[model samples]
Target: MDLDHEPATRAHEARLWRDDGWTAKVIKNGDDDGWAVEMTQEGEDEPALVGPWTMGRDKKNPKPLDSAAFITLVKTASEVLRRHEQQRHALLHKNVTIDSGSDRLRIDLDIIPDEYEPYAELSAHNGFGEELARVRVQPGFKLSRESAADWVANNFARPS
Candidate 1:
């Protein structure tokens, strides 16, 4: 997020309209002579989508925002953000189960790709849902039967 990527875009002319967690702002398109609209949601730093804007009757200025059109834009933009979040959630979290001697152990991996610090956590849970171990590993840490077995055998210390 952080539409702040463009400082000038941070503060533009007043928004034409806003509804359903979306704000629509029309701006002159830099690539072409036509205008473009940006739809941003509350708490999100970036706009969900941006595309060409329709022209008004004058055929020179962009068309004014209307209730029906704005509502449609809100739904489309919301869907875009929702799908993005879901995809990231799937990529950041992973789970698996492996047989550790007799009792089965559930393994979970969560990755945090921070700008300054990227890391992943590997955790083990017993059949009864008791946490056996949690260790911080590199972002590229591999989760597999062999790795889980090593962790369980090494008293939870991170594999060398």
Candidate 2:
């Protein structure tokens, strides 16, 4: 870790620190008139995690950023990023397959959750690497083993 970019060690003040591509900053909390800290990964526009800061012994002000506290924050922030990536992976790539007569059909459900509108796609591919059909579906579309078989039986028609 670069010392200049990293949060200063054994210090007492609301400051910013960079370590292993993540940045941690302690700032004043606008909501509660207290201190809050934000942790953001490098190149990301928004902070991955934000939480209330600890108060000093006097209880009137936030505790100065220290090595132990910084370490804890880094661990917590890392977890937040990891969970976010896992969720995105689950949403973007989902697959299932069913045997439709002689050839097996692979069903894929891809979802893109946008702010304005979320959409999903239901696609089918045959065992010989042939695309049978593709259709747009609602984000909340229910998909299961039975559903995939039914869709195939219906000649890959869009499910109602």
Off by over 4 Å in 2: 1-14, 97-106, 112-142, 154-160
Off by over 4 Å in 1: 1-15, 43-45, 153-155
For model 1, how does the per-residue alpha-carbon lDDT over 60-130 read when each residue is reduced to its tens digit? Answer: 89988877778788888889979999999988988788887789999888999999999999999999999
Error of 1 at 121 (Å): 1.6
* Residue 155 of model 2, lDDT score: 80
lDDT per residue (tens digit) for residues 24-113 in model 2 = 788889988688989877667799899998877888778777667778888998898899899889868788988888888899888878
* TM-scores vs. true structure, each candidate: 0.72, 0.64
* Best-matching candidate per lDDT: 1
Task: Choose the strongest candidate by TM-score.
Answer: 1
In model 1, residue pairs whose N, Cα or C atoms come closer than 3 Å (at least 3 residues apart or on different chains), thus clashing, are 2-45, 3-45
